[model samples]
Target: MVENKHVLEISSVTTSDRGVYTCKASNRFGADICQAEMAIIDKPHFIKVVKGTNTVLQCEVAGTGPFEISWYKDKKQIRSSKKYRLTSQKAVISLEVSSFNSADVGEYECVIANEVGKCMCSATYILKDWQTPLIS
Candidate 1:
């Protein structure tokens, strides 16, 4: 029963869970041990924006690849209802608001995960009256 690595799925993993994970595999030839270290992290920072203007929210990370990005509002998944556009390049991920409004005011999230580990980042923006700010 030789294996390369072990897979573990956990929700709400925190810094306290940071430690080493060991996998033991034995075969007729011999036995081997594979160890992996992981550290839990806090959510991403929020970016502020104004109303009636285009906005881009970004999240950056290290030591991860092939991630999955998601947008959220007040902690809920941002639905794909044709109001938001998200794009990723290499390690950079961003959310594009074509037409900004009060509805776009909230927190956005970028979730990254690879075969080795997973991480998440967050961004928050508020939509203010862009025209009104210019008057004052």
Candidate 2:
């Protein structure tokens, strides 16, 4: 006697993967199908940098690539330049915003995407002003 069977495993699944998945089997007579669904885990951590100094905003990602990484300041997309530097190594991507100032103190968003899917995350950076207050 012989039996045919198979198995599928998913690692580090997110909310998007929670939907129902269908598996189909066929024989000479007819066909059979099965389905399964599951929930998953998820967040952003805070980052701090000194005022008027260079700062790096990094995002951590997992799974397969080629991946696209992007940085945003206050809902606006940011690009790489002399003042802004972008770097990527494996699962980590970073954006360096040069000369961190009052204008740069705000919410930042890091968007990571691959052929499989896309994930968006946000974190806030607090600025520590180095300028001393003038005496009256």
On TM-score, the candidate that comes out on top is 2
Quote model 2's TM-score.
Answer: 0.54
Task: State the lDDT of candidate 1 residue by residue for 1-136, as single tens digits.
Answer: 8856656776788667788988788889999888989865444332322222247666555543445556676777765556777766665566776666666666666666666555666656663465121100
lDDT of 2: 0.65
Worst 10 residues of 2 by lDDT: 44-53
- Shift in Å, residue 86, candidate 1: 0.8
Across 1-136, the per-residue lDDT of candidate 2 in tens digits comes to: 6888788888876667777788999989999999987644333222332222246666566655567677887898988888778887766677777766666667778777665567776767664455221111
Alpha-carbon TM-score of each model against the true structure: 0.49, 0.54
Global lDDT scores for all candidate models: 0.59, 0.65
